[model samples]
Target: MEEIRPDENTKPLTWKQYLVIASLLFGLFFGAGNLIFPVHLGQLAGAKWLAATAGFLVTAVLLPLLAVLAISVSHAKGIYDIGRPLGRKFALAFMVLIHLTLGPLFATPRTASISFSVGLQPVLPAKLAQPCLLVFSAIFFILAFIISYQETTILDSVGRVLNPIFLLLLFVVFLLAAAKPMGAAHQQTVTAAYHNMAFFNGFLQGYNTMDALAGLAFGYTIVSAVKQLGKTSAKSNAKVTASAGVIATGAIGLIYIALIWLGATTLKHFKPSAEGGTAFNQIVTYYLGDFGHALLATLVTLTCLTTAVGLLAAFAQDFHRSFSKISYHTWLAIMTFASFVTANFGLDTIIAWSTPMLMFLYPIAIVLIVLSIAKTAFAGDPVVYFWAIGLTMIPALLDMLASFPPVISQSPWAHFIKELQVRLLPLAAIGLDWVIPAAVGIAAGLLVHFYRKRPKQ
Candidate 1:
């Protein structure tokens, strides 16, 4: 095999090439957790599934596309570049946090846990769930590690083979759900949390799919994939990046709607379950029975494995490049092990803990993306980034603190912050308290930047 070199090719990509990249992005986004989130949201939102899905699409699909475009347009090779204007220390810290959240700490492990929990564990004995989880996760991560061990092969594995099979199986589920309806979605009872605030709750629900975080983390993977096709010039790469992102997110958006409808209608035969895995399992069994179990096992494994490998490959590549002394394989091993350990904590537990972190990181990630895309307007000014990020962090941190489990969040300091947030934050009622502060920071930064640059008479 010969080495592949990227050229300064600025021409438009053929439709075939465009489809391939779109498929790759779609595979990366529509993974294990992705399957469950919107379905689960449907169960929660019930009658308001459409409104809820709209909010989910904003973060789950739209924000992620923006994140990829941010990388391409800003010419950022990775998260480090995206945050470089914030200063080296902040940039490094931000990169590590982003990687950890999107890697072993949450998203990567969720791939394994959700796959096992959904596909197989329900049939096993209660006592067996823990032991089986251990066995399953070990095998899952090992397979993921082996696949991701060779980075170049990830595109082929995900885009060509695994993603297509999972989609086929998913199509069967969707078709059956539509062909024979469980019940009218509009007649289902909306849960209390989503009764009045379905959209906002659904917006926050999108946080669970973790696509937005994965978007920032997958920056190098998408850019590298595009370059492999010889589109290396900034303008060309940005165009392709934005286009592929749209194609991919468009597919994901449709899937989310179908799944949400599935969830809402299932309420006829089933009460809203604690998680999407349960709703999905009930629907599959109703439609396909024991055969569905085998099918789901394969479907879950394929979807989760592809995503796991992609995350591991991206994680190892970025970490190895950043910390050269620690070999790529070593970093891969470290994350793989950590993720396996975390997976055994169970799917619900992982999600419960994940929310707080997602709450904190989502705001920061959004702000960073916005700054990167609008960098030229402010001339790539660090002051703008610093103010925007710093102010965003205060509210983001409060949200994180309040989102934690009652044992922690109910404490004096945490409660104080949450109370203060409710009292003072403009959008606090809707769980978007970060918006006002972030905008104010941007306005403040631009004002200071121009003031400092004005004639010093």
Candidate 2:
């Protein structure tokens, strides 16, 4: 809890301090999902890696950067602030949903499950995998619980030691893969989804990373860390927060590119597999032999652990702050239990079930972030926020329906609704049915705002 302050005559923080904060932010954002998705995309995209990655960067990198900047510049206390312009009830509801999605409901459990499946499962005997997962998850959440228990030092703990190790291990993997090509980057046939619109497919695929949502979740934490570093003024905090975001962005972007290339090169030697974890495991094992497996396991565990700790701490802190009757330690304990149980469901099931929920939530989060950042352009009107998000829900709902299990999506009623959505809503096929509606809502809201403020005729 010690706030590091510089002498009045000195700069706010040295370059070293900024690097540490950036490293912490990187650690907070880069999780197991980050590892799996891009590699999968690379395997799928084959020759279209550049176009696909460009689109992936928009949502995966740009949106996250913007979310951090939006939170800082808005001077919001937390994710709730971004939604406040919509309405208090809406703010609370949205924040709770976002937190749960990013917490026990999906992302947090996923970190443990993915690390287990990708890192640990590959090395374990077939029969031992399930039991090992249970054991690993228990230990994983316990570690997260202990780290997050002392929330004050979360930034320093992750930034100083954990992140550097994760980055160094990852860099070694990337460098080895780059220096020695696995195989020629042959042009394989593009998958059905990416056949023509690879970029947009990549755009939608980026959603799987869930980093943008994390951006909103972690924004307050980043801001608080900047303040802890003695950048207390609103403007100063925003500046440092943005700087830290840029540093994290650069680091994440480079790693993503490297991973994508690594995945692509594997296609020449191995066919695209259904599970990214499998493909990733093969690549590591091929390049570094058994040694690479241990290194990857270590890398995945540390990366996922850092992310889980940040999320558990963030969620516990927010809920405890909101409901003071329940202590932060109690909430952390509750979350740890919930996440441990959820992680036992296994990574694939968690991902399969969570996709529909993410489809529903991500658009709303994106619209909120965009409007929050552009509040000045709309004169900070709450009406704009309300209308835009309200209108967006229509297509977002359709998107959720589209991603539902076949039992639901293939039902007669569901088919009729989806058919109607595809016919009426632009970009429905691409899973972006919300865009046009949101645009119209923004226009309508702006007109209403101007009309309401117009002088008497």
Candidate 3:
């Protein structure tokens, strides 16, 4: 065993240590949403699965890997530090919004909903469905709260226990899927929405995993776990963190491909489902029958439990730091309660409502992570941060409105705003209208940076 001293610079973590952190990272990010969304994308993309899968990997896997690197390379302890160049008030607000989205409001609650909808809903009678969901979510959040009450156990709980079981269960499905595919995906008909722009829409679809946001939030947990392993220096931590992230996201990427492929193949047997949960259920039930449902229920519940713990811990840690008036346990309880309430809204409603929020937040998050990773090249200029983020916000908001369901989006005022967004912004139809504005802001900010630093000649 290697001695790991704290406070001094240390060597890179050994392979064993690296695997531990990777396991923890994979488990933290690989909950129910990860399973549901990719499977759903496969159904939608159909014959277009390959291209859509490629784009899904970019956002779901690559961006998340970059998000963790952004935290490590910048020496940011949390999301707030990543956005600190923009000033205190701005950074604080950014942190709050992220915590809320990834916390009680959306992602945390989603853990329970995904578990319920996919694992259990298919087996219950329709009349009992709604009430069963309420009971399930309550049990789910209570377990998460108990597990999260002891943050010190996260590494052991997730990495050693939960993750291995998840991998084992998932491998069974993958093995069966690969050994006997239902039908040729390429032969399947591509859905209308995917006929033209499957790749880009798939890119957007990855937003539901929320792993990019999770990456940023989970930095503290990842770093803390590494420190517990004795890689103490900032540089050492950064290198180890990046290394573990690669290993973890690599595993996730492989699973995502398999899941999407599974969904694509299932089109031969099952019709399309509204939320991915239905598709996931169909695929699993086809392979394992009633026994598969039980297995899936166990799998998702454990996966979601670990994810809930991670989110609750991160939320409590960040909130406690910002608002010291409340203690960590208190914050944990508050978030757990809130997530329980939201989870009862049911999976479909949660997915529907979360679309616009994800669209709003993802663009800015992508820009922030990119800029933070490149902070050294630009001298960590505040002007660059302000310009890039400020300009991106407007289009991101428009992206949100544009993603709303027709009921809201078709209204006169909403229609007019969307039209302006489409007319004024490039890639508006693709939900990437923020890209050009973000680029322009980056350029404008760089001009200011160069002007200020030009050697007083």
Candidate 4:
């Protein structure tokens, strides 16, 4: 393996290479959650779409962009490097948890299930839905495994072809929706959750997308891709990576806005559903009728397949690097097989199982990204990371408890803790109970850091 040196002289990537890498990154991040969440948000937010969309974009777009930039600028090898300031043990644990969450645990299985339910379920006959889902998921994971099995060609295969086709099909749906216009954007009745604090609701909703986490996970892969494009030096890699991020940013921002607008306008014609997949299917069917099913099925399948490939490849590569005894091929096979089995649990169950974990992990991920980007201000002190993450964990744990299903939530201890959190923690009702504690931790950590380093009196 040729090592990428910090000082190696390297040429910058061409605009074409940048576009390909950017497309690949975009495809990786824009999986099941990305497609469903925004459209559902637009429907729920209704008249408040602008403010709500802004909130969604903050976490969904801005934070993920910062995450990628942090990785590039720091020249970190992977997510483990980002968490190194915490401790070696902590870094390894965090990286493993992140990989699991983003891989076979939740996201990888979701790609197949979401596509099957939303895309194929509507088109297939009633009796065939079950067996078809089994067949579809098997095929989906097999294809993903095949694509990911060859690590080097992922960018060329996914970026250069599949992603563009996905975009074109998506454009057809969006363009026709705009041209036809589905009744005016009406200020429809929103759910109780969205009626008040819609912006915050939107912010929390964005957490489900998990793109920021994916950004961190995908950082090393993007860097490798950049190196494959012949940018070996740290500076060249960072520059190319940042440029690719910009292109992805533009692409994602435009798609989100379009999807949100589509949802908002179509609300007058169609009632909103709890599942974005259902709403999306209805919207497509309304415009293109039965023919739209084929278009949507193709788009959804490709979108999900590309994302699963990226994730499986990234996860396998990281784990293989960490534990050299386990070969990359073995890890890839394990991930694909696990994802295939989990996909059989279906979309709803996966979402239910994953939500609690995501609620717990998201706040920590956000704090880490912020700390990484601002590490210089604290002189890269480990104490800062320790304090910030430790304090943030308190409320993050509580947030997870709050999101627990009835079995857990109905417990006496859970009820007591829930009441305590709501009573004592600021913003607990909106799922942001960690904000104040994190701020306090940062301030406290900075004070200690500066005091310890002060000149002798």
Candidate 5:
């Protein structure tokens, strides 16, 4: 290990040590949502599985990798520090946005719903399913609250327990899927555009996982693990971050590939459906019969339960740290109650409602990831950060308004947006209302840079 800064806060670990940390982080990020979504995408993608996988990997895997890199490079203590270039207000707002996205508003509750559907529903009677869900969520969240109350060694212990369990369970399922193929995949009927478009949809869907944000938040924990093992220099930290990212991505990527392939094979036997989770369950039942259901139930419950506990703990700790008046216990109680309410909305409803939010948040996150990785060019240019962030916010805001089609159709502002859509080339190209604005901001920042640098004489 390299001799680095000796700050009490910085601990040292080796490259191998870092890889273990990264794998643990990866397990934390890979939950029931990760398992379910790709299967759904593959089923709909049909012959376009390759395209969909490529798309899914972008947001699902790559952007998250970039986020990890961003934290590694910036040495940010939190998301707010990374966004500090834009100013304190912006950084705070950005942090709040990320926490809310990953916290009770969406991801936390999702952990419960997916866990229930995959784990408990198999044994519950059809008539009793709704009531079962209600009871299960209550019990699940209570356990989640207890686990999340503090930072401890339990996280590592749980990682060791569940990580292999998830891998082995999925490996068995995938092996069986391959041994007895789900009949045959449908003929590739999707047009090239649909293939191309699936990538973007997958990219967008990736936002729902919020791993990109989690990457930013979780990077430091990995860093600390490395430091404890006696490797704390910037270079070693980078190596650790990269290695961990590769291991984590490789592990989850394999899982994702297998699930998506299974779903693709399922297309031959199952019809298209809106709810990916339900569709996934149906396929599991078909192939493995009753045993399959039991296995899937246990797998998802463990995945979802662990994730819920991790998230709730993260949110409560961070929120209490950020604002001190509220007691940690109180915050946990409030967060648990809120997440319980949201969980009732169910998986399909959660997915439906989150699209607009994802659409809005994705671009800004991408730009930040890009900027973070390509920091040299924009070095010391606060103006660039401010301008780019401001530009990205416009589309994000509009996306929220236009997220639901029916809502957009009935809104009085629909005609105005329609008119703007026709005039905006970038929006037309990718439904990105902010492309033109981002370009303009980049140009403006460069102009400002040159203007200030131009021979101050």
Candidate 6:
């Protein structure tokens, strides 16, 4: 094959080209996790679906899109490079956190639960489901290993094939909801503040999906994809990459909105239960009948299966890179075993434990993304990130402790912080004691930046 060179003088990517790039990113970002969260938010928000969905979109859709843009703008080679401003230790931890979040502890096992529940369980008897799930996950991971080894086509092909199927299933569900919305139409009950605050809540929830971190890791994949699509110049590729991001964000947003609408309308038929997975199954069966349930199960399983494979591949790749002592196969085996154990806890339990930790981590992740994209102004200074993140850490750690107190009774600092929040701080809500600290960190970073830039005598 001949070598292809990127033109130094490239033109802007056309709209058609941009949409394809966006669609590809959207496929990578949207999967089993994307389906349940917004739907649940819609049901809770109800007439307030618009407000809740708005919040949901900020996190679910917008932040991930911002992450992709950050990667493109920074042109970072890896996750650490994008987050390198936070100092070497912080960057490693961020990498570890991002990988683990998207790995066996959370996203990987989630694949198993979502796949089995949505895809496989409907056909099997309750007693047989667990065994069947084990068998299915084994085969699934093996295939993922083989395909990922090739590293060229499998992920792309699975995404291309599955994206349409997933969209079709969603459309069928939405159509059924539209033809006969579940409950009597009620007036929307969204408060002005909730509506106004939608952006922050949505941005925060974006953490649940873990796409922003993935964007930092996988932005190059997108840049390469842009080049392959004939935008082979630096300027053209940059424009194309950005345009694709816009396209992906728009598409994902539309689907999220539609699902939220469905979820809000679904309340007319379903109740607000704590069980997200079961609730999803119930809603699908109710609206679309047996066929809908079957279709949903299949779609969820396929999407989750692909996602599991992808995560396994990522875990293996990152682990091998981080510690060259382990062979790639060893890393895969380690992750697979971990995933099996974690998957047993089930999706609801995982999501429950995950939420509070996410509250602490999400803000830090957001700051990293914004800073990475705006790295030019900061001159890639680690001190700026170090102090900013160091300040944020106090609150993040406090927030984590506040979420689960009994586990850390020995720590005097935790005790002091908890007492301080109760006695002195005016928090926005119970879980977010970190808001004040994050603001302070931002202010500190700006002051330091200007001070360092001042002319010496």
Across 1-457, the per-residue lDDT of candidate 5 in tens digits comes to 1234644435554466656777666765687788778887777677777767777887788778778777666666778777877888878877887788787788888888888777676567888877877888899887777776654557567667876876776777777888898755556345345566876665555666777778877666766665666655566666666777788887777777777777777766777667567777887788778888887787778777777777777777788888889977788888899999888877777777767667777778777766666666757478877777788778766666666556663577865775575565465435566767777776787678768878856
Error of 5 at 412 (Å): 4.5
Report the poorest 10 consecutive residues by lDDT, candidate 2: 1-10
| lDDT scores in order | 0.85, 0.82, 0.85, 0.81, 0.73, 0.70
Candidate with better lDDT, 4 vs 5: 4
- Cα lDDT tens digits, model 4, 1-457, are 1344763445555688888888767765676458788888889888777777888888888778777767765667768888998888989998998899989999889989889988888777888887988999998888888888866575455555665676776798888887887856556656677767888988877887888888888766777787787777766776777778888977898888888777788788788876688788888788778778677777677777777887898788889999889999999999999999999987877887787888888899888888877876887798888888999999999999988777897799999999999999999988899999999998888988999999998
Cα RMSD to the true fold for all candidates: 3.1, 3.5, 3.2, 3.0, 3.4, 4.2
Which residue pairs in candidate 6 have backbone atoms (N, alpha carbon, C) closer than 3 angstroms, thus clashing?
A: 55-202, 58-202, 58-203, 59-202, 59-203, 59-206, 118-297, 119-297, 183-268
Provide the clashing-pair count of each candidate structure: 0, 0, 0, 0, 14, 9
From the highest TM-score down, the ranking of the candidates is 1, 3, 2, 4, 5, 6
| lDDT over C-alpha atoms for residue 289 of model 3 | 88
Q: Any runs in candidate 1 off by more than 4 Å, and if so which?
A: 1-7, 149-155, 228-230, 455-457
Encode model 1's per-residue lDDT on 244-336: one tens digit a residue: 888889989999999999999988899887778878888888898988877887778777777788788878888989899999999999999
All candidates: TM-score: 0.94, 0.91, 0.93, 0.90, 0.90, 0.86
lDDT of 3: 0.85
* Cand. 4 Cα-lDDT: 0.81
lDDT of 1 at 164: 68
lDDT of 4 at 433: 94
